[model samples]
Target: MEILSFVAAIAVGFVILSWSADRLIEVASTLASRLGMSILTIGMTIVAFGTSAPELLVSSVAALDGSAGIAIGNALGSNIINIGLVLALCGVIYPLVVSRRIITRELPLLGLVVAFSLALMLDGDLSQTDGFILAGALVAYCYYLARHSGGDSEDDEEVVILSISTARAVVESLVLLALLMGSSKLLVWGASELARSFGISEVIIGLTVIAFGTSLPEMAAALASARKGLFDLVMATVIGSNIFNLLGVLAFPGILSGGLKIDSLVIQRDGLAMAGLTAALAIIVVSSLSMGNTDKASGSTLSLRRAACSYIPRYKSAILLACFAGYMTILGISALA
Candidate 1:
């Protein structure tokens, strides 16, 4: 097939994948609720994981297909995009702010998950043992979140409860699951083909094309939340997606492939970059607008109209974007090598 044909397949795959993941998550959450799970629990666990369904499904397929580099890269690359792309872009277009609640909760949990996952992979092997540990961590993290979230979320954050019959919901969920699987397979095939046709490594393809593609939903969600200054939703959307990426998406390669051997550059370069960026996000999450601010906008030029610590300032947003650009450059150089 021509390159454009491959690109078209990937584009269609991402659209279908996003739609299927959303419907499936809603149906799954409803089923969970029927099984006695709380709304807060559903929001924290199902919704968060569902948002990352693209990455998780993609990685799982890559692992199963023996394309472990793409699996690993999707996991790490998506996390980088979440912080450096999605979060930064949101801050740039809106009066973004950091929430104290995020600083105390989701942010730290994300940091812990990233740190643990990196430590396990430092040996350059994504082994089943590593997968087990990460999976256990994910389970423990979910338990913590579910227990702490209480019975309901009374905050400004809204959880939509769908009114639907269980039998119909189950049927709809099964259909969405099939679509999700098919789309993921299509995306993986297109991405692998594109990588081979262009002489690009799977890791680079996974990091740039597939990573950004998987993160599109996140960028949309974060920007929407930032537009309204909804701190909890913004943080939850990004942080929650990221946490699951590390634990769930990354773990798939290890478990499914029975311990795949990864590229050294993954640990030496991409892995460290991911770790550093997470640390940067944690630091930025606690900072307020008092640190620095640009002058107000004039003559239709854009500038910060609000300076709030509980909100991110323009300069910090710029920093995050810079980090993203620098990392992309690194990926470019590595691909050429």
Candidate 2:
């Protein structure tokens, strides 16, 4: 009976998490647009913010509770799951299309960020210095994006129009942010209790269950956007969510705990899998760009950039899902061992 209560808490937490995350994305995007930001980049910004909200809160809470495994696992595991499982499953259903901007711009940025994260963790210690570095990088990256990403509209669209009032958006953002934080705490507590009860290592529980739970928002957003023929949104959201996962979500343990010794398997098996999958995705995106049916749009590089686009076919989706299956098999075997 007591165990069932933990499970019930997790279930309830997930429900609130999904709803609150979705609302937060909407309000935040509206607020950004109201603040004169371009609509082109708002989806990536707010959707990632909304999806990563749970991971940030849950990991911070886990770290404060002295669960280092859950903290790191939730961050790296979500990156693996975001690419391998959630995005792969969506692509399998309806192959996603992305712009050349993603190929040349976003993909490289992601690689740079992932490499930085792994470099900091290579010594098996996530130091306070490393945490501060990542947080600072996140701020710098956002500023870069704000200045460069959609600057083509620098002339006419200086003041973007949004329907919502600034005051209302602020209130809604606060309320949704609070709900997301509360649900995250509930979910983490329940997951920790179950991990102890089942005699499962916190690392395994964090990798398998809690990672998937926090990723629920991403999965939901991807599927909905895919159904609406918004394949670009689907792809961008995945990349953005994973980026924030590494930066904001992963920083919690190092920041709050001052420093924590990384588990062996975390830096060995799981971290390797994450880095490999990330590299594979980048290769796939670039290859797709190279093969895209593009004609020269103009003499200018910027002209050609805006004109290039491609889609992930069902075959590519199948390949990604196969990789995902292989990864899960490894995790399952490790758990049993």
Candidate 3:
């Protein structure tokens, strides 16, 4: 009965967290627009951070509760899910056009950030100094995005123009933010209890259940965008969210706990897996870009139709899906062992 209650609490917590995050993004975006920020700026900065709020809150709460495993697991696991699961599914549904900006700019930046994270964790813990470093990187990244808004004019025009008074927007944003934080605390507590009851490491629970729960919003958004044929948006969303998860979400736990101990399995398994996946994504994008250009130079009429078609073949998606499935299977076996 106790175990069941914890499971229920986790479920309810996830629901409330997801809802509050969505509302928070809406209110915050509206507020940003009213403050003279462009919609592209709002999308790149506010929306990106808003989507990652759940992970940030959950990891911070776990750190404060002294569950270093949960905090570290949530950060690394979410990055794995964002790329291995979420992005792969998006590709399967709609082969994403490898945007130059993503290949040349965002993907490399993600690689560098992940490398930096690995370097920090090499000493077996994420200290307060590491947290400050990551936090500073996040600020620089956000500032760069703000200064260079890449979204099309249509995206800018699609910004929700809220008629609410500035005072109301601020109040609503605060209320939703509070609710998000409270629900995240509830989630951490329940997830920890559930892990204890199951005789499983909190890291496993955090890597699988809690990671998936917090990633629900990203999955939903990716699916929705794919259906609309907005493949570029889907790619941007996943890449940007992963960056925030690594830098922003991971930093919070370090700051809250002063330092979080590294789980050996996390370093040997999850951390290496994340780096590999990020590298694979970069290779794919770069190769696709080169292929597209080569095909164009060769005067292939098919390549002239849509440049993306030359690069993202249907079989590539199948390969990505298979890789994700295999990774999940490994995790399941490890958990059982």
Candidate 4:
């Protein structure tokens, strides 16, 4: 009966999650197009952060509720899922053709964050010092990305401005963003309550259930773009979300929490899982190139067949799922023991 209840909750949650995610992407993309913003910027500021908002909101609420473990776990688990499951699935669906810029910039920063996160967790808790350090890195990273974004071309920025006036664009963007935010809140509420009504642990619920819940927009957006042959948009949505997870999802909760705390075991396990997955992603990128598969070597430039071979060893998602399984196994065993 308990298992049945959990399954039922998950089914409903998945439906709501998918519906909400579609709405989010629809509104965000429409607004971005209306406001003269690029899809990349939309993915970075609006869509990316919007999708991650659930994790941020849940973590903040968990921290305030004094369930710091849930807060920390949600943040860490979501990050792992964001990079591993989300990116891996995106790649599998349509190989993530790297931009030379992404190869030298975004990938390296991701690796650094993975390393830095592990170093911070070398201590039992993520103290204020750690929080500030992480936050500072985030700011620096954003600054770098802004400078190197290679955006703001005369034609790119100018094209949108001519289509819509600034005042109208601002109003439309705000209204759309508000609707997106409100729906997301409803989705999160439905998810948490449904999870509790079942017998699922909040951590597991957060890792698998809610993580996938929030990622729905990216999944849908990417697939739609893939079908439409808008491959750059797909890559932007996938890679841009990764950047947002680190900057917004991970950073927001720590600042709001006053301090972030995790069990040493949680830190070690989740940290290793994230790092291992990130390393696998890098290997997939490099190896795809070495094998004369330039499709994934740069953005939207690879052939379909080569792009398919881009994610060899596919250990990012597999390892994360395995580690999650192992973590849950230990949890279940410990509880039963």
Best by TM-score: 2
Candidate 3 Cα misplacement greater than 4 A, ranges = 1-43, 150-196, 290-311
Question: Model 2 off-target regions past 4 Å?
Answer: 1-36, 149-196, 290-306
Error of 3 at 267 (Å): 1.3
lDDT of 4 by residue, 172-286 (tens): 5555444444544555556666766667765566655565555555565565554443444555566666556655566656666777766776766666766776776676666
> Any idea what lDDT model 3 has?
0.71
TM-scores for all candidates: the values are: 0.77, 0.82, 0.77, 0.72
Residue-pair clashes per candidate, as listed?
6, 0, 0, 1
Every candidate's lDDT: 0.72, 0.74, 0.71, 0.57
- Candidate 1 lDDT at 284 equals 76
lDDT of 1 by residue, 77-159 (tens): 99999889888887777745554456667678788888888888878898998888888888888888766664332223334
Candidate 4 whole-model C-alpha lDDT, 0 to 1: 0.57
Candidate 1: segments with Cα more than 4 A from true spot:
7-43, 151-192, 289-309
Ranking by lDDT: 2, 1, 3, 4
Kindly give the stretch of ten consecutive residues in candidate 3 with the minimal lDDT sum: 296-305
TM-score-superior candidate, 2 or 4: 2
